[model samples]
Target: MKTLSKKDIKQLNERIGREVFSKKDLLQEECGRYYRNKELVFFTLPQGRLAPSLKFLLKDLYLPKVTVDMGAVKFVVGGADIMRPGVTACDEGVMQGDLVVVVDETHGKPLAVGEALMGSEELLAATSGKVVKNLHYVGDDLWNA
Candidate 1:
């Protein structure tokens, strides 16, 4: 692990559009290049964009949310893409390509982080199809890392 310089932390804050933990708390893992603070971990996605791990997102709770029914919990935790039928609610401002948290409706606990396949309005209006593409979840490599 390596401590991140102030410059690196500043750029990360810019990329995520907000200030995060202080430099003293931020470390970059050597193996996966994942960024870690005292509280959470995040990493670059396959699309080459930075994204928070599901655990990090739970602590931060800043992403727009896609709420799913209890029935969908199993599939969601298993890394299945979110299907329209299982979605119970969505934050209004979500847009296509936006990062969103997938939460269980019952407890409002985040289950995964995904990229929106459709806007919130469209996702709620649709009947049956894959909507959000699951990118990170509880048992995924990122979570383990």
Candidate 2:
């Protein structure tokens, strides 16, 4: 892994819509071309956007959230897209195409990070069909890396 330069870090911050990395040791890993600090990893999605790793989600969960029922926890952790039926709650202000965290209702622990397929109102109103596209989850390759 190589340390990121200030220019690279600035671009990354813009892509992820956050300015969390300033002086932290930012290392670029080859396993997934993920950017990492001492405690968190950030990965690039298929669309070329940066996303938070599950570990990062746990540490700084400022993203909008969607709570899933216990029955959905297994699928979520396995990287299944969050379905409408399984969602028990959705934070207001969630918009379509926004990054969101999927958490289990029992303990409210993040199970996966996903992209919202619909807005908060649409997610809460829908009865069936996928609502959030799972991006990263526990036991995924990125997680293992």
- For all candidates in order, the CA lDDT equals 0.85, 0.85
Clashes per model (N, Cα, C within 3 A): 0, 0
For model 1, residues 1-145, the per-residue Cα lDDT tens digits are 7767878777777877888657666577554355665434677776678778777777789999999999999999998999999999999999999999999998999899999999998999999999999988978777776
TM-score of model 1 relative to the true fold? Answer: 0.92
TM-score of each: 0.92, 0.90
Which residue runs does candidate 2 get wrong by more than 4 Å?
Answer: 29-32, 37-40
- Model 1 stretches astray by more than 4 angstroms: 37-40
Question: What overall lDDT, based on C-alpha atoms, would model 1 receive against the true structure?
Answer: 0.85
Compute the lDDT of residue 48 as modeled in candidate 2: 76
lDDT of 2: 0.85
